[model samples]
Target: MAQARQLEQEQGQGSFVQSVKSELFSPEKRQGNLNIALSLSVFAGAIVFLRNFGELLAV
Candidate 1:
């Protein structure tokens, strides 16, 4: 009935999510994560320097 249909749909969705999660978090994803971290660090460093440039100039 409706309950059985709902259970089947839930099982199907769960398997799809697991497959996607496995793919997304594979070894290749580690490299992507590293790249993102490096990019963010560089961006933050640039912003910090720009915001404190006056203090740096006074030194």
Candidate 2:
């Protein structure tokens, strides 16, 4: 009971971390945070595209 109360305080109200804990770190919650994901998508896309073009330049 006390542990549940402590979690709400440390992780913040309705935060990603708290939700992640609640969900037992499932893949769905792992992908829930958008800001962390955008950069990865951009990077992966850029890499794939650059490899096709044989250039490291940004599209």
Best by TM-score: 1
- Can you write out model 2's per-residue Cα lDDT over 1-59, one digit (the tens) per residue? 99999997777865877766767666676666565678889999988887898664655
Task: Supply candidate 1's per-residue lDDT for 54.
Answer: 48
lDDT of all the models against the reference?
Answer: 0.88, 0.75
List clashing residue pairs in candidate 1.
Answer: none
User: Best candidate per lDDT, number?
Assistant: 1
RMSD of each: 4.1, 8.1
TM-score, predicted candidate 2 vs. hidden true structure? 0.39
Q: Name the runs in model 1 displaced over 4 angstroms.
A: 1-25, 54-59
Residue runs of model 2 more than 4 Å from their true location after superposition: 1-32, 55-59
What is the Cα-based lDDT of residue 16 in candidate 1?
A: 100
Candidate 2, after superposition: displacement of residue 16 in Å?
15
Question: TM-score for every candidate vs. truth?
Answer: 0.47, 0.39
